[model samples]
Target chain A: MTEIDWKLSQDIQLLRLVTVGSVDDGKSTLIGRLLVDTKGAFEDQLLSVRRKRGPAKESEIDLAMLTDGLAAEREQGITIDVAYRYFATPKRKFIMADCPGHEQYTRNMVTGASTANAAIILVDARNGVMPQTKRHSHILSLLQIPHLIVAINKMDLVDYSEEVFKGIRDELGAFCAKQGVHDLITIPISALKGDMVTVRGDNMNWYDGPTLLEVLESLEVTDHIDEKPFRFPVQLVNRPQTPDLPDYRGYMGQIVSGTIRPGEEVIALPSMQRSTVREIVTYDGNLEEAFAPQSITLTLNDEIDISRGDMIVKPDQMPKKEREFSANVCWIGDEPLSVRKKYWIKQTSNLGKVMVSGIEFKTDIHTLDRVSTSELAMNEIGRVSFKLQKPMFFDSYAENRATGSFILIDTFSYNTVGAGMIV
Target chain B: MSKRKLTQLQALEAESIHIIREVVGTFRNPVMLYSIGKDSSVMLHLARKAFYPAPLPFPLLHVDTGYKFPEMYEFRDWFAKEIGAELIVHRNEKAIAQGMNPQEYGVARCCGALKTQALLDALEEGGYDAAFGGARRDEERSRAKERVFSIRDEFGQWDPKNQRPELWNIYNGQIHEGESVRVFPLSNWTEMDIWLYIRQENIPIVPLYYAKERWVIERGSMLIPFYEGMEDQLREGEKPTKVMCRFRTLGCIPCTGAVRSSATTLDEIVAEAAAARRSERETRLIDHGSNTMEDKKKEGYF
Candidate 1:
């Protein structure tokens, strides 16, 4: 809290992770234990949790009460929405998404996993891998989460047996492998008894792997934005026209991918107008160069009629400009998504009217099988094709998440109805 | 320092700036809620940075409850003029005429009329499609699940149970007429982050946050500042005492409690907050009304 050196703190990597599992798989308990063990919970919060004891024994604390903040959630003894928790260790800072386990809240899990770099899927040792586990894993795979940790929880109930851990690990590994998830790790833990969560537990001597926290801290933090092709979706045009600098037309936006340097030639998409980067301006000062995720304004050499919803990118590495494309859609609205229905599609800074042209199939998360379907209901995932009123710049989701994803908004209600990942 | 690697504070600032720009780009008429607090100061700074070179794309709306600390009003007016931001101040004139005060009518009803109702009236009169707030997730439990772009119904009610799923950096600012979205650019920022950013950016904040010797009366566990002409509200044996104190949050003078401290600088405040054992909202009297924060948010409170 004492003002630390800002430059040195940049090395402290940030890991966005999600905790998922079936109902009562100890997901909330694990998160609570992590926070409590790390001194993330303040003294007053701990006291309040102690005061509001559910029906537990007098000496025992309900760890699940920490994440269940809503009154309705506490009354029902279940997580109803995705609750984000922040905590920091010496090695790294973490923003954890504690997602709901109910089958109906699959959309909530998708929301949490979409931004996560890794996922910790909790599996009860007694139940092994249930149908919900497979369902959650499939969604994570589709979302392209980089890493996954399968924590075989409740080892205390299973006598810390190596055989049970191996059996569950092998089964879960096979399932994940079939789904093309290669970066997977499995550990045995007892969240209730504080085993292998923060510290190395002696109860799990049979397992010689890093603890959950250690694995999370040591995982590679991928910076895909720095490596991918440059993609800048212009959000606004700043024309100050001041006496100090007349005719100043700067395009303002956050660089979604790659870097921009002075004198680099770029092309404005949808218009295909070419220009050179004249300057990179920030509130602090002008920068020599700027990279992905940095919100800066760029002064182009050309005086093209560029406005909002325009994209500036490397000419040779331009995203495909098309009017029709296939994408994997996650239906999130109360109404079903039908073919030929018009809806507004917001991709990056571009907004366009789109209609579903075809529904190829829907994936059965539990079975990992494709079923031929004509319509997608609420919380359903399907591979569909859409026809846009105007050409949109894009990339495949597997290549770049920033430019590959979009949302479908209801034309009448203006509610976000679907999330689409371009295929 | 490597230009490729941004510090955590820098990363948070970039994300917030992105959100602010998105609101300006998508919404027809957007306004920022300026409460003249540290969070709002950080938010206003980010808005300026987000649309630099050009003036701010939206006006700033401050809901004056008619009982805020005098320093807060002074800072609000001075800062708005300095930044040249179009500022709009709204108050429930009818409620004031009806003599609605927290001490007379209790905290909840007075807040409902002066704060919540005043805001609803302002939004309607301005026809603002998007209003940005500076609420953070780490401050309260219910806010931990709030989306970056939260949608409100025509009546300005927030449906916490069925909020839209916010994914990645993409925010959904789509809304129909009479319906508005409450955007929280600082949703991911914590209290520590706010102070650190304020110090790092050298942003000007109200002087009330710093410690000063002020007359206060101890009510239960709170140190309520003694205001002139409010002598009848005191208990039988209680008396006002001058103490070195500072406000953790700026609100109505009667509701916002001051913590006894001598942390006069931002660095000291950051260190004190880090070592403190209680959350900032714990001292707020408005939060004590039957889980009032969530209930008020449901009733269109910011």
Candidate 2:
């Protein structure tokens, strides 16, 4: 078989979204508004759902039921996990992950927002910006979500005052700027009364920003950073020395960064095997080139012993494959992550059994303080050091997130114990 | 300067690959949960491509929700042969004989008892550390909130409130003794995208999804196929509808509903599916309860 390359596209086309803020910040309500206002929900489906829905306190439509579709979820009257919503505006489609505000489900928010591009941090106009607002915004920035929208909800509760909206928006603006947020858009709306949802509101004539749905539609979502270097994480080796194509020996992987063209000079990681790209094959058809996040199988002109767990990149520029590194981690398990424990580390396709060699420090997410610790307990976000058995090809998490991040798997019963972003 | 654009399939493929790598690296013996639904069919296709030329190192696990359509079994048997992957089927014959159905114990209880509970038992019995599923985030609220590497306790219960932090694209599959991870490779693929993919790839699916002539009894706005013994339980008051019906989704013979349609080809199905803004889960009355999936997940449901 000829070497085939699967290039999904040159640009990342999907948008990962999330709604943040503290309890009763109307995170759920805002999501409901976005989905409903966007006309993303079918009329028949909506009607049926409404009819079957349990009676709310005042016979009002339980908008939260739109996202909190689970039984235990509606019973609690609070979002407990990440409820993902798929909607589309005329501009682009989006996957909006609705995260809970309770401190207990902070980890869920982190998970949901990690892959998000834009976060709609709901701020109650009555309460202004609270600690949870700061905490969530910081987490979004840390996760490298490109855009932030501080939604001042419950405008009606505050009598739709331009002063209330301005105050909340300005406070958020200052804080986010200090936290390094560049694209913070402040919007005013009422989730209960459906003001400025699908339609702009006459009540808030002073506020002239795009509607929440419009923001989602018009958000600038081109890939962050430069696609200067081509980096592919080797997933599998395709060697079909069969009757069809005996000489076929190819390395398959998804390009984590940059672009790769056929006949381009490339180097395989660790071994640093230099070769020219022989071919790029894809399912739709063959392409002359490919880019980050696209899955492809590539053939080299030379017969190099390339295998899965190895990274392929341009010979001139390659990633730093290191044995030891520090990372900010969100502890997931009930038991604390002790230094003595051996955890399974997966970076791209490479596998390395690792141990927490040292406890560098932990981040008090709310305060941004680094605390020295040898262990991280459940629901705690911290920093730690890991010693690996084998060197892993990685970039700084901030530089190339897809290649630089990894998860620590508990070897024993096999549950994802922790997720780490390489520093 | 500009945010990268992510395609529907591209995002799904990346997420799936990430999950696959996590399973291979973390678990001792991982298996793919195959229900032979369009989702599972798409999942298996993804798994094959994920570790291509390696003959997919993991086996396939099918928890027999005994009420599955016959065509599903036909596809399952054929797919196993075509792909040459190991397949394991888990059936709770006791529940079948006792007739522990959705009508009796309620949809949640029935699914929880037969499908969810059966899955947990089978995993423990097989000593499989992880079971890769085709759950999409858009399927349900509980599932949307799930991590790619979802963890289950010794009893195999899912706690959405206290899930691990999943950062970057990295998925941590870690657990204590007896605990396992329910890995979802298609968490990002939407229903429309899956249909688009199936049409693009020409992935053969069960005929149930297409418009065809079949004997069906209408039960609660759903056309439950006339399976043996199931027909007798058909509500005496209602008459069966024999329209050229196609299923928007395939669930157990009981709860899954069929929409009246004459679209027989994949293109026609795509057109029909595109028009559908409602989720397939909505078609299944058994899961309509608010937080039902979450509750069942808490009770160790897949």
Candidate 3:
């Protein structure tokens, strides 16, 4: 066995990805194969999986048992919620969100796909492209996930024929082309037989592309987060007033987009107060600069009355501050979303009462067609207009995910009933 | 690597700090459930950093089962004093008065009456709208399905089947008067991540985690550390033996089992964890049965 290079592994970047497909498309099994083949699962965990096996073929280990962690999932033989799994290779560390494939659990899929940098849409080779396949692909496109891998699983059932894989690949390619997917790749694999998933099987000697793990390892690590304009949502106001530094006040928050430097002029939205960055303070000490996603406390040169729900941004790159906007919303609550019903709209750090002004149209995920609708029910995605009681600073969801997205909470129940991405 | 770029540990820290700050910004009255374990130590550290120029905006609550390791209580007091945090210590005095013991009543009922009941009573008495816990999804099977912002009904019961969909980093801290939200900032962290973060940050933890010579008795396949009150519960001919042992998880002295190892430092602990055959929760006595954690969580077990 080769010696494990712990230092190099520690330096590798972490990738967040999600797997989505229709039920019984071998999504969980593919993840299990990856984990088991990579030795991510410990001996005791494998033993537990083996112990729980229910009289399968003597030689076959039920791979899906690895991801179906919940008791209800095991009893019903279907995944109900997103299960997060971790694994690391020599090239990169990965956090995999295994989303449920059932139609009613679209909200769960949306939840899983929200943070994912890439998505793996699995398809059974024998079944080719199903309606659920189109649905997942469309959702991935809607989420603006950077990369997509269409794995034609269960290739052994088709005798490892290249023609069968090509048929499914072409169908998906054509569909993704129309959906505006640029970074799309497809591979043939039998998740159960471990073909083209981790190790290249002998049966697929005709195929020459990289395996599933190779694709994940070599994918581009784009810094798209830092390319956008500076946007920092104030979460807290810090006042230590210590003996050494009496009267020190700073705004604490995580920079959601672009870079911020000391002495840069910024405007706090809603209040529209102007200030200059005095310092960026961290636990290690003060830094000259900060970038997207780094948590830091910013001390301004001016004593502005900025509080939470305020967005500090570069003067020239100001986001839209408005009370009315249209957005694509996914209804997550059991109750249907009615027009004019009051709900709490939480956008970034800002919270305000909002009501649905109009329901434009809902997308039929399977057919990729827009159908007019007056209301959005559970697990439905639609474009709607909202009128907020107060103005909010935001960019389009395509420009910056952190500032563009919001969730609606039921006024009375206080449950998060809907998720929206600003158009 | 770029000098400005953050390592995975640093990234995780930033995310957790953002979450802690969000909880403070969103909820009117929130509290941190500090268990004096390694996860709680990390969580407390993040909370401190989340509001660095100022002290923590909220208080820390420790639900004492009256059966925890004495070292845990000591560390809890010392850490609270060091951070200058408002620590609220509560226990189910009624259960203690009723003489409910894990040794006699079994782990499930004892935990329900002591730990779970104590937490609920404290939440109610304090009227806390949001409570932060250090639960991680990698710890147990059912926990893998838990949302970062988990909602509880008026009875403080979690309905797993009807949980609201959590998308992106936007957590829903919205709740009615009697309802509450359990916020877990460490939801995505694993055991390895916890140890790595603790080592990187130099966070203080209970000494029980490091191997030490202690009196213990072999029970079934586990080595239970001998506490002062265990004499009456010991089986016939079960004599105490001195063993070099360390606890994988800290809980009630009677329920938590120690593993035999000489991992005296965080580095050794991380190496041991990487090469270990079993998960850390395998030795936990409360999660022995199938779906036990799920059942406990539905009834308000953090």
User: Which of the two candidates, 1 or 2, achieves a greater TM-score against the reference?
Assistant: 1
Best first by TM-score, ranked: 1, 3, 2
Please rank every candidate by lDDT, starting with the best.
Answer: 1, 3, 2
lDDT of 1 by residue, A151-193 (tens): 9999999999899999999999988898888768998999998
* DockQ values of all predictions: 0.55, 0.34, 0.56
Ten consecutive residues with minimal summed lDDT in candidate 1 chain A?
A: A1-10
Candidate 2 local Cα displacement, residue B233, angstroms: 3.2
Q: How closely does chain A match the true chain A in each prediction, as TM-score?
A: 0.95, 0.90, 0.95
- Evaluated on CA atoms against the true complex, candidate 1 attains a DockQ of 0.55
DockQ of 2: 0.34
Residue lDDT tens for model 1, B123-145: 99999889999999877777888
CA shift of B101, model 3, Å: 1.9
**Candidate 2 residues A1-423, lDDT tens each?**
111111111232567788999989887877777777766565554664567665434336667778886656778788887888887554556888888888777777877887887888998889987877877887777677878887889999988999888888787887777757767888898987788777887788888778877777777776643365777877667665657667667677777788888888988878877889988865455667676777777888997767767888887787787788888777776678988688888777776798888878876665667888768887677778888888888888888777877877777645567778888
Preferred candidate (lDDT higher): 1 or 3: 1
lDDT of every model, 2 decimals: 0.87, 0.76, 0.86
- Per-candidate chain B TM: 0.97, 0.92, 0.97
Angstrom error of the Cα, residue A235, model 2: value is 3.4
TM-score of each: 0.96, 0.86, 0.95
